[model samples]
Target: MRLEQQPLSQVPEKAYHLPAGTAAAHGYDLEVTPESAGWGYSGLRVVTLAAAEEHAFSTGDDEVVVVPLSGAVSVEADGSHLDLAGRADVFAGPTDFAYLPPGTTATLLSERGGRFALCTARTDRHLPVRYGAAADVPVELRGAGRSSRQVRNFGTPDHLDAGAIIACEVITPDGNWSSYPAHKHDEASATESELEEIYYFEIAAGPQGQPGLGFFRTSSSPGHPIEITEEVHDRDVVLVPFGWHGPAVAAPGHAMYYLNVMAGPPHPAAEAQGGRAWLISDHPDQTWIRSTWADEQVDPRLTGERS
Candidate 1:
């Protein structure tokens, strides 16, 4: 990836689609900061540690959530210690997590080694450090048929109380699609909220352990026009500064998983509303797809049954 500064027109494609290892920084395999994204709030860092290894860092001005992608880990932050029971892989279901407020120092150690995702958001409000148990995460099955997907709401505004960040995980079965109907949240209004988003993906391997692949699309949205339709693989990332993004499709036999990190300024009309929310507007032409879901049965794979 080019590191030297260049005009957006000169590096537009590279700016949004980051292949594996292209965004690495600060000892992490993948790092996308608010500064790096040319945005103000959301960030994500992915790291893998060997058995008995330790990693430490200060939260600085960002409130962060430590999510394990695999293996177990123990986190110590703000005078508190918590053991996170992580999953075997992203396809293994939800895993516990730890939250650390800004300006705090923390350490993470894995007895058996693991891969972790640090989701962050720059904020002034300092909430207390806390642990989110895997069992407490709400898993919702959304859409139906080809659009069916599983959503694990762990750090979403309605689930975890944070200053600005809103996060969740989506699992789309092979040959299905998620993030459909093409939506945008690039405007701040009573019906929409402006939030920058980061999509970190992981594609489950094939039966013979071959690499997996998928696709992602982000198209123009009014004044905040942009476009990206790229083939994605394990550990790849897509950044949405402003645009309508959707139709993340997993190729046949390749299950897909993505961690979404989002954060933005509070809506002006929300001073009395008392909560940050994710409000979006779907593409007018594709909005009709939502109605079809009402008549279709959800894909059995997402209902805890084998496909």
Candidate 2:
């Protein structure tokens, strides 16, 4: 994998899209750091382990959530141990996750080989480690018609107990659109919040195990300089420091899964409040589509069934 500095004037697509082996290290299949992303907060690491393989790390100054993308695992953190009953894969359904506070050390062991995602964000607060059950995850079928998708709000601000970071996983069925209407969260105000987002994608294969593809777009906002529209595949990542991003569309015969990692500036005098929120401003031209979903039925694929 090549590691080089890129000028700020270049298109973001050139630096985004870290392929499968481009960022591997320390038993991780993919790793993205705040410094590597040229951002202040947000990071992700995907680790794959063989049966009985063990991996451990300390959070240092970043809080982290260990989410299983496939198979079950045992997590030991801050003197407490939790065995997570994970799912067969991302499309199987919502899996249990463990959140580790900043500065805590944790070890993960998978008796059965599987892939896991470490969603992280830098923060100064030291919250307690907690476990989230799959049953507790809210399965939201958002949008309608071709724009429909399933959102697993397992770690979103309104659902989880955390500081500084807000995360979620979205599943866009075949031929569907998600993150629609294009939206921006580049300004700090009552209507918008400044945030950095990480999109880690995994494309599902067809019934016969055929490869699939998808499309993603991010356009420059008022003063921010970033624009990209690219073809995406499994394990590809798109970093959004600032921009209007949307319309992540999955191609026919294949479903798409993307884990969204986001975090922004801490709230003023609300550091101890334990409340988290994300504000977005939709693109005026496409915002009207929001009214259309009211009459359309959500896609039947979002049946909220666990495999």
Candidate 3:
């Protein structure tokens, strides 16, 4: 039950993008605190819309999750049902994801400079919202090296894919270290529990911008460990649960882009689906991590999300 301490720039940027960790993302133009400032739920933040204004937002108490961690956009809640989508791993990667529920009152349309990562979850109730992403919902990337994949969304298959969300998109090579020892699904009593997490990062270097970003925290045991590898830019966020949540995002030759937003309270045998039942586990100490990264090679274009 940790990860309490938010303050990534105080949140207050109508049209702002300046958190340089990813070396001033060129085509990326980052933005990290939308509707969630350290987990409180204030003025409804998280903006990175490059040019296309129809302005009309309402929903201030929280309860929102408009995630699109990369490309595609076009929403219009109440504005007149005009949905267009792509993101959550390019519309289906890392286990498909996309939802904007709480009340409504929305309008976000992207022309071309689309690179999203918006997720709001506070809850109050806005009204008049929007979202549209029809056709081509076939994302596939079923594990290899470091695995766990399942994002199959067709058209609100049942909605509720996940909200106490623990997102993902990890590409760790170079020395390898993906979520080591550290463990804790927050805690929700029987039925699993405690889950309040968020970690956003995008790093790319190796032919020039070397030094890639790495190292994270939540450890002080199994031999006392607490380190934060300096060098992390591009929408930086480290809102972990508690101690023992180790080795997240490792880079030594560039190639690490993290996007993990999680929600807890389910799992532990409480039954009823048990959250997601650990999803997939076996990380006591893979001998130095990398348990099996043999050179790794998962990039079938890496963008369109397994089209």
By lDDT, who's the top model here? Answer: 1
lDDT, model 3:
0.45
Each prediction's total of clashing residue pairs, residues at least 3 apart in sequence or on different chains, is: 0, 0, 53
Model 1 bad stretches (over 4 Å): 1-11, 269-275, 304-307
- Model 1 C-alpha lDDT per residue in residues 128-183, reported as the tens digit of each score: 99999998988988888999999999988778888888999999999999999889
**Candidate 2 residue lDDT tens string, 99-208:** 99999989999998799999998888778888999999988888889999898988877688787788999999999999998998877877787677999999999888
Ranking under lDDT, best-scoring first? 1, 2, 3
Task: Report RMSD for candidate 3.
Answer: 18.7
lDDT of 3 by residue, 1-307 (tens): 1234454334332112223443233232443333333443221134466656333454434335455555556666654555455553432343232455565566667665355555544433332343323344443343334332223333221333432333444554444555654455543444334444556666665696555666565533233233333445545556543334656645556555665555444445534432433333223554344434345554343433431
Candidate 1 achieves a global lDDT of 0.88
**lDDT values of the candidates?**
0.88, 0.85, 0.45
Off by over 4 Å in 2: 1-12, 268-275, 304-307
Candidate order by decreasing TM-score: 1, 2, 3
